[model samples]
Target chain A: MELEELKNLWTELSDELEKQKNLTDKIIMNMTQQRYTNKFEKITRYESVGAVICFLVAIGILWKFEELDTWYLKLCGGITLAFLLIMPVLVLRAIHQIKKLNILELNYRDTIVAFEKARNHLLMIQQFGIYLSFVLFFTTIPVASKLLSNKDFFIMEKEFSLYVLIGVVMVFLYFFARWGYRSYKKITNSAENILNELDNGV
Target chain B: MTKEQKFTELIKDNEGVIFKITTVYTNNESDQKDLYQDIVYQLWKSFDSFRNESKISTWMYRVALNTAISHLRSRKKQPGGSGIDKIVQRATENEDQEFEDRLKILYAQIQKLNVLEKGLMLLLLEGKKYQEIAEITGLTESNVGTRISRIKQKLKSRILKS
Candidate 1:
């Protein structure tokens, strides 16, 4: 139970481990041949795909800039365009920060602290995206309807489609944001606990 | 030797460190295997950038330790679980039951430590010097000393009480 006794046990274990290798060279070689993924790879892919879609939509709006004949439509178009253009960069930048952690290169303290900061940045962006998405939701519906469907949502006699689009986005955003926030909070809390242990041990 | 060959060689030489580290960070057998592969993958991912600025062991420790801790953050920690016994059973399948039981007990005590404490204790138990521990963990030597002593006392009490 003593410290030295524990060390002795560890020594015995180490000696045994050295003699008995679980991972053979063949298995390790296969491991080297295999590709390993980071926990954030999925997020990176989603963000990247979202960015591309946003960029494409922004381009579509620009390609059909003449469709914005009225002042209000243009304003709505402008708002949607800006959000589409900016959100991806912010999201991708956050993803890039996480990718840049370079865990293999940094020491434990730096890696954890950097990881916490990156996660906080990401969480902030996600929360900001969620809240700001409502405004985008309202603007994008009209602009997208105008550009893609050639239907003026405001002037249309039948407003059922606009309401349906709004309902869908509202539902999707509500559930997705709620889930993303809860999960990210869990991950951040776990990282923060380790950071606390590092600063104040035992 | 080629880069992949060298990395493989180094990993082969230090396979036990990775095995032991993964075992400590994770409780379940599947997770341990996943973490072992993850650490090797990270090591190779960063292998090209190693540059020999520090000792290979120190560098490997940093990578393995960081990867293990990061990998654990995503999953829920299940302390005081029966998973360690499964790993012990497999690791010591050919050895005597008494040694396996003792190993299981040691791991159980370690599983109770906090993430940071676990890393510090693993380094200490591996016979790493204070300077090397400080280097791998990016903590000042004095701070490592303080934390290790406190963790040591804490572990001793927990073991004795149990």
Candidate 2:
């Protein structure tokens, strides 16, 4: 077909397109408004688990070191425990805010956006785990020496081993956070590229 | 208006942008609709980052083409059938209709072109200049001009044969 002929056809099609614009626009608007629930759920689950672990660890620390009577240890333990208890609740609230309501289903684009947001949230949560690990590892030293002084060799050795274990876990969590961040970046970039293609009319 | 409301208005105004692109790229109504929705969803997700440096339509075009190309690539990975097969099946269904007969044939022929060739022809058919097509498709301006001339001749001969 000649260029002019093609242009004429496109002109006719464009007219038809204009008629559907309102309907199409509504669909787009609705789809864009819906959030991806599955990603939000996953984030919530991870955060909840992190909270539970931190809480249990805090309880154990408080019970084991109760005899030491050190204000610094008590304060550190209380703060870590409080943060551990609160982090999951905060994450859950954020997840709820991003969830799609019962009135509508999430569209493809909204799902992508939701997933990106969830990924970022999870990455932040992972960072918190790193910070907690540092606190636990460093604070355990003075607390362990003071509290474990009167304890048996077996108990002291076990306490030292547990501190080492916490350090290893922190290192793992850091790498995991890095990996999650990279994956989120990759998916977002690919999604953006696809959007660009659609915009160009190719 | 709220940010979301403003965003919706923008989509409502420019939806034809997606519709026209999908119509040109897909041979069937269903696929066209799917591509259109995909494009819109992508645009909405990226709306927050949109600066006013370029025309909204220009930005929309860039996003839409990138989405379509990525969709094309991913669809290539599926088994049992390809997007081309889907297009051809739709085109063949229109064989009996007089008005659509020629357009169907054209679409079938267009589908036979490789990715780059199809991009060039689609832009040419849309009346984009060689320089504009070059900028969009990342081909040199001279190369775009040469390719469009070649594709036009090739398509004309193919349509003539039909």
Candidate 3:
């Protein structure tokens, strides 16, 4: 059939849908009222909320930093505050990149490119977050030992158990990073394939 | 009326666009409803920027097309995410068998199209001009003309083969 005939059929299908009694005002109202928040919107909201919370926590820690008496505690406090300060900026930048993706304005192809870039950027942020977490964990021990020594709870002596604890954390960090990268790869690879399909044409 | 009330009214007027786009993109009844709701959600998300710069139908087409395409791409990664399955059967419950058969053939032909071609064909079927199709699709007018001509030829040849 020609485009004209097909157009006729198309109109018929639309008219059929229009005439259906089930397509009532109530259904339409329900659909409109529904907060069908897509995944990206939810992610953006979570990131913004997380950034605010992180900012507040960092401020609180800096405000209370002087109370930490031991040298190692002060060093760890500086490190933690530095990390906390840096992380919100990165998160805010990411949120900005995501918000800038005007999918409604860009052509379909440009939209795909923009979305992929944003996804990759987010993956990098995720990797950075995991590494920072490992740093925080490792740094916590020195701070804890310092506090313990100050209290005479324990003395700093190099021990096999210390080596064992470090070994366990290192192993855990390695697996965590590996798992994170794999998850990141799975999503980005899927997005890449879709973009390739669009480029290659139908 | 408030901005949201106006949006709701505009949606009610152009709800068929959602139905049409969703039908072209998805084969399952459940997915069709999911895509319909999703398109409405997306249109609302971007409604503040509508600004009367384009006709209401034109704006609706752009939002619906983008939402439908992205929805399909993401649906591939996680199928069956929309849990509600049985809602749209009532809409199809009374379609005459003859009309149903014609729709079947039409959708079958559309299914054979690539994603981009499906969008073009859907726009063309809605009687959009090549200029507007170009604008909505981000293809040049000449590209829209050539591809649509080719699409027509392909559809004709498929009809002949069938």
Query: What is the alpha-carbon interface RMSD for each candidate?
Result: 2.5, 9.2, 3.5
* 1 versus 2: better lDDT goes to: 1
Note the Cα lDDT for every prediction shown. Answer: 0.80, 0.57, 0.71
Worst 10 residues of 2 chain A by lDDT: A101-110
The sequence of per-residue lDDT tens digits that candidate 3 reaches over residues A111-158 is 656666776787788778888988877655655454434431134567
Alpha-carbon shift of residue A91 in model 3 (angstroms):
2.1
Candidate number that wins on TM-score, 2 or 3: 3
Q: What fraction of correct interface contacts does each candidate retain?
A: 0.62, 0.24, 0.37
DockQ of candidate 3 relative to the true structure: 0.35
Q: Model 2: how far is B9 from its true place, Å?
A: 3.3
> Clashing residue pairs, candidate 1?
none
**Docking class for candidate 1:** medium
Worst 10 residues of 1 chain A by lDDT: A32-41
Tens digit of lDDT per residue, candidate 1, span B44-99?
A: 78888888889989989999999886673345556564255544434433757777
Q: Give the Cα error of residue A168 in candidate 1, in Å.
A: 6.7
Clashes of each: 0, 24, 0
The local lDDT score (0 to 100) that residue B59 gets in candidate 2 is 60
Error of 2 at B96 (Å): 13
